[model samples]
Target chain A: MHSSESSEVEVKDVKNAGMPRRELLRYFFAPKAIAVIGASATPGKIGYQILYNLKRRFKGDLFPVNPKQEEILELKCYPSIVDIPEEVDLAVISIPAKFVPEQVRLCGEKGVKAVIVIASGFGETGEEGKKLEEEMLRYALYYNLRIIGPNCHGIYNPRTGVDTPFIPERRMAKPEPGNLVLVSQSGAFLGALGDWVSQERIGVSNLIGIGNKVDVDETDLIDWFKDEEETGIIALYLESVKRGKEFIRVCRETSKKKPIIIFKAGRTESGARAATSHTGSIAGVDAIYDAAFKQSGVIRAESLEHMFDVIRAFQRQPLPKGDRVAIVSNGGGFGVVCADAIELNGLKVARFTEETYEYLRNRFPPHYGITNPIDLTGDGDKDDFKDAMEAVLKDENVDAVILGIIWQGVVLEDEVVEVLAKVVKKYDKPVLGSSPGGEFSSMMSEKFNRLGIPHYPIPERAIKALSAMVSYVRRREEFFRDEE
Target chain B: MSRILTEYEASKLLSEYRIPMIGGSLVNSVEEVARTASAIGYPVVMKVMSPDILHKSDAGCVKVGISDEKEAERAYEELLENARRYKADAKIQGILIQKMAEKGTETIIGVVKDEQFGHVLMFGLGGIFVEVLRDVSFRVTPINRRDALEMINEVKASKILYGARGRSASDVNSIVETLLKLSELVEEHPEIVELDINPFVVYEEGKGGIGLDALIRIE
Candidate 1:
């Protein structure tokens, strides 16, 4: 056991010498060959789903190890991992809980580098199950096997086509290939978020459900995502953090390079009680978590919907240089709402320079107000929004712009999406939009998303998205400055 | 399960850590109280010292503005009577006579052990401001000087400490230094489960601050 542990440490040191930590998590996400320890022949079993999902898009080799079946999914099945002639990079274990320990021992002996345990009823159950989970962890540590979870849905990497989740593709919505990577502690939330991502058309790079986190916790995953080239933005849904100090340190380091948006549940007393039972995590004081998030550069999303909004904004826009926002609206009411939201979110309404003011005053109608919320009267057209945005975005004082298009206006047309998208692309600064109404607004918003423009349904949410960008910019600046 | 320490022991421990405080001493009787009060100064505050009593003022065991020997004697006797009236089983240690701190902004520094986060330091507006507004900021210790200053600046009404409303700015650096020292003290003594320095009077800038009243609990 000592030899195995020392050998593992040496391998890790050699692999990480002068190399980015991204290489540490390479096998888990991009394994060359994976073996399914409990690969089954039946259609309704979890093993079948795991194997089928892997074959659907994964480009790597798949080995199904099943003593009972000769071949499953038309692939030759070995009786066990030890029976395989070649070494395996990763092993997906989906057998019953009682029979998982022996399978893990065999996988370790076979020199499998990584394993994802997808079976349930360990640790989340009573003391006996917890003991079984501990034994499995002991074997994993002694053999130097990096275990993902004892009860999790598994992983999904759209870019690499490594879909290890048990849930079928049809039941869960699979988001398109994008830069955002999601790490969720709950399997149920991970599955649900996948569907939401698909429905919202939000792109994703990877989605991992870190169940129980018996061995691998948020700290390791964050260190990996800190330098992962494919991941542009990282999102996390956590009930509790096992290693608080390490989590904060890694987040403080990772969020400097890319945004790490998080949604933490179990804040209230009852919610904390529920969390402790659900994941066996001691939900510490919520205020401490809040402080930790602020100290680090991690942007905290209040709810799942809020997280999506923030992530979408981050995905579509560049970080604002400052907190000064310029609001452009067709209606005066929307302008007022956005103006209040900007200040309420610790941002300032950009006081345009005299030259930009003169330019906007000449472009809009004579009666249109040319204040911070460059109010284009209700009779404004796509040309009016385009002109106003271009003029406001020209001012060096304005770090971001939140354009509100009240679809109830007569002159507003679907062409507004193209015009706004063009203006947003022209500006290096962040430009967010809000179009709040019925079916027409929803359609336009989707078009806006596809055009690489983030559009919120409400004025407040748009400003909120803009606020998140400005905050990220400041925090990133602080992080970089401190490193120097 | 916390073990309470008398004000004398608490002050001795604090002084060892270089936490500034007004000169005073614990006296066993009214005669000793008079002698200590005269030695410290004319205007001295006296309180009944007892480990059982958490709130000396609330039990009417505190007397301030005692300017003479006669008042000191009468006040010490009254404090003893009040301590007995407040709790019959209370073990009266003696009277603690402290020189009255100069008027300034009242601030509080405290430390409490959290089950998961370990020792957390709390800083806030002290005295009636703390009771009325409940304004406080907390950070996990052992914090550096920058973190200590950040804690001082985190309170919503921290402007008052920075000379707001025509008031002179208090000695903020002194408060930060005291916080750093207290953090070190807690780090050195693991048995100190909780500590509070309430009404830590902050004089004008350049003048030092003093921990007017303190209570330490051990486990």
Candidate 2:
């Protein structure tokens, strides 16, 4: 709701820094004119693939830079960025590393808004590559040119059709536009993750692969995304943070308005060594990062899978009002598992109010256990599920609900998906689902996903996701209290 | 890389930060030690004052519960003898005679300079529990009273400090005050590489606690 005010303040911050911040990012993601340097005619070349991907839906002026080819892909080709007639906003440089410095110099000479250097063999190599990258950074700073990556896959803003990741559409999956923005340090990792996201139909607003963040780091992008109206949540996959103190401060401010989830790599000695070699980042003591995250109220995900799970939950559900969770499952064993997970995550298994207990008892049969985990026996049907869920949701003490549908019951069918979704929306409280099976469960989960209900394959994971939602609300309240 | 400060020097530093310390005096001779003990009252404690001795109790340089002047004199001699036997090349400055602090729950408050995040403050239940259980919580320095309060409650043994099992609660506010004051001191003095107040005696509520021993190291 306060996004507009925060965005205005961000615009002023960008203006004070001597760069129109909003326009600069817009140029990279939704530029009116783009110059693709090193444009190639060969179908298999990196430059050719980038141009092909942009031609799909980039509703802007596209200029191909190729000295040899006069006309490539039906667009006039220029030798360099300076040859372009119209004022170029962004330059996608995908040439050899040796020729990148001069191209960047020309980009600065032409007053380009931002440059995404998609070349490799810098910094990640050895001392020589490090020196070369240092020289490249010098040129970018001297000309006031903001850079995204020198060895990264670049950005993919599906909302604007700005696909600069050098991968063709045929080889990649493109999901629809949604509100989650993913910022990753590893370009290749984002490549594979993007394909998975596409297959799972997980919509994203922005996908940035920040490789060798010399001129622009994660904090700079975080500051920009904090006020973005389209961004509902910000998720990061980082090996190291460049500016520690500023990162904490910005996150502390942003997390108050939008939840920030991070999947920090290099948590172990061996993992740290691998990260240093991969990204050339000096991953500091893991404990210090832990303390910093706690101080800033940034939710931490244990792994990539866990990050996706939590992000889906945050994207699908509203922030849980409290830590008290009510578990309603058809399988008694699953309820036991959810109970263990809820307590393990420091969440209480809410004791249903006397009225809620009485209501639940009438909804289900006398044989069904009507306690906190109101176990609706194996014979429970869609009506039993809806009645029990609605009863518990009305209880003042119950904050959230986790419904486990085994799907193997004789009376249960796919209709339960809509029943659960309607009740969740009516109450405006978070409700996570668990359906663990093979083909039927997977198919039913997609149906649940469409209804904006995050369904986990197991009871423990569903409870963990619900617990994360609960913690985000609690942490934000703590921050709000501090502000007061 | 770090040099330990003497007991008297550490106490003066703590006083500068307004962290209360048990009243003590550094006396040079046996007669002076006895006189100081008698002046402070009976059942006093004596320790060998030397920079070379980091762990005074382990080196047998610490002697507590002396009832009279004669016992204080003997403790001084025994401390000197133990200091010599442990490390003959060590420099023995004198003896520090302090009033015996009343028995209370022991706790530890310390700070370790982290390479990435700067100074981090640590608090936990003191004595053997600190070593065995390792129950502690850390926060970046320059913490306010609220942060200090959270740090105290973050430790599991905090229940013990909150009057567990019908015992009177310890003066938790005093520990919070000490934490805040230490944070200010560490921020003011960049050279303070590490500081430890092990066994910070926390008395009953309404009666503030005192630091019986303090160690400050400088780069």
Most DockQ-accurate candidate: 1
DockQ of every candidate structure: 0.23, 0.21
Which CAPRI level is candidate 2? incorrect
| TM-score of the second chain in candidate 2 | 0.97
Interface RMSD of each: 9.6, 10.4
* Cα lDDT tens digits for candidate 2, B1-219: 767787678889999889998849888887787678888998998888888887889899888889987788888888889999999999877888899999999988877665556666778887555776657777777676777998899889999999999999999999999999999998888887677887789999989999998887787
A1-484 in candidate 1: lDDT tens per residue? Answer: 2111233433442322232223436778888889988898899899998998898878888999999999999999998898888768789999888888888778778777778999889999989778878888777765667778889977898877778888877799788998888999999999999989878788888999999887777878888888988899999999887766567778878978899899999777441321101011222377667656776678999888889999988988888889899988888888888889899999999999999988877777778989888778788888888888888888999999887887876777779889888888988998888889999888888888889888888878888878887888888887777667
Identify the candidate with maximal TM-score.
1
Instruction: Kindly list the per-residue Cα lDDT of model 2 for residues A66-88, writing each as its tens digit.
Output: 88989889999997788888988
TM-score of each: 0.90, 0.87
TM-score of chain A of 1: 0.92
